[model samples]
Target: MMSEWLVYPALGVIAGIFAGLLGVGGGVVIVPILLFVFTTQGFPAHHMMQMALATSLGSIVFTSIASFMTHHRHGAVRWDIVMGISPGILIGSFSGTWLAAQLSTRALKIFFACFLYYVASTMLRNFKPKPSRQLPGPLGMNGVGVVIGVISSLVGIGGGSLSVPFMMLCNVPVHHAIGTSAAIGFPIAVAGTLGYVVNGLSIADLPTPHLGYLYIPALFGIALFSFFSAPFGAKLSHKTPVVTLKRIFAVFLMIIATRILWGAL
Candidate 1:
């Protein structure tokens, strides 16, 4: 029990660093680790994935705030873009979580694993969008937000892996895209968390230390360290070759995705 206490916070530190460094919400890190921890801790098999997803979103609420503030200090975040897409994100995030509650646990695991692999491949290629069109109007941005929010909520991610690429496609600069994505995570986390909580309330068998589907202990442990470490990652991003780091992180994502797929099968 003591080891788990230490380990969860340590995971938060790692998740925070990665969130800041990559503009990812750390859900990519949090979900898999929680899957392992909950399974080992003898949590009910049926509800473990739901709990993990809920907790991942909960931590992202804090992690995104920390990361976004840090990026805002550097003037990287695009508040205009955030405003344009936020409404769609809020709607889509809640919708996606509701949909996830309808799916089987195995199906959700497979879906998330597949999504991770796609994100990993995109990062590995470092694909840059050609300046094919000017930045979209509000409607188009909202559409993009809907997709990002839906997919992110389903997979327990912050939507950066999808949003950064979409923003680049709209001719936004990479750094600004990353920063804006960090800001976007907040709406996704908030809406998704609420949806999960509501969904869990209808289920009678959730374990203790939970607020709805969210595991309170894990949320506290992860969010606390994540909040502190996010700034460190934000600082390092400027000094580091972020492209290289992103690719390395992508490789790590692929490895984790493979492990998840194996387990799901």
Candidate 2:
């Protein structure tokens, strides 16, 4: 058996690459992987899924930082848009955690897997939205941000799937949209992580040394490698043909999602 020491860092490297390259939160994949790892570690089945969600978001806090900084250095992120939407993101993310806490573990797993399928299919399509208009006003962007934040918190993603499409629809180029999505993920991760932490604090029988629902060791292990690896992916985003890789990764998500769905049933 591979030790968690090895496994978690490996996961971080893989997730960080996906985060930087695709402008995704990497938690799209990280959540399910964490669930599997947590299961192996004998965590309470009752809280396993949410803990996975929380831990995934926690790791993304580190992943998004490095990823966005690299993207920012490349002049790909749109700071104006990130600033405009952040208020709404924080409000929505903070509330979404409470909503997540109310769901049963099985229900949450099913819902999470369904969302994963949606993310995978979107990637496989590689659909670029046709730009129909300029970016919305601050009020409109904030309204959209609320929706993105709520959904992101519920699903433990960094909001890339939603934000990237929204940016493209606003006439941003694909690269710019990806980078901007990475930036946007920062607020989502911060709020989502806090939400999960606060929501999980009252629960009992959890693994110790946790911050709310986050598994501390998993968080640290993933964060350490992701910090170094995200910059590499960010650089690759500018130089590589990420399309093929995204499709391959989408298929991987599909398989893992199916596994989750089966367990939920």
What TM-score would every model get versus the actual structure? 0.93, 0.93
lDDT of 1 by residue, 1-265 (tens): 6877898999999988987776566888899999999988898888788888989999889878877887799899999999999998998999998888888788889999999888888788987776567668889878878888899889998888888878887788888988898899999999999999998887888888688888888999998999999879878988999999989989999999998889889
Cα error, residue 251 of model 1, in Å, equals: 2.7
For model 2, the superposed segments whose C-alpha errors exceed 4 Å read 21-23, 234-241
Alpha-carbon runs more than 4 Å astray in model 1: 238-244
Candidate 1: clashing pairs of residues: none
Report lDDT per candidate. Answer: 0.87, 0.86
Report the Cα lDDT for candidate 1. 0.87
lDDT of 1 at 42: 92
lDDT of 2 by residue, 120-170 (tens): 898899877899988999899999999998899888888988998899999
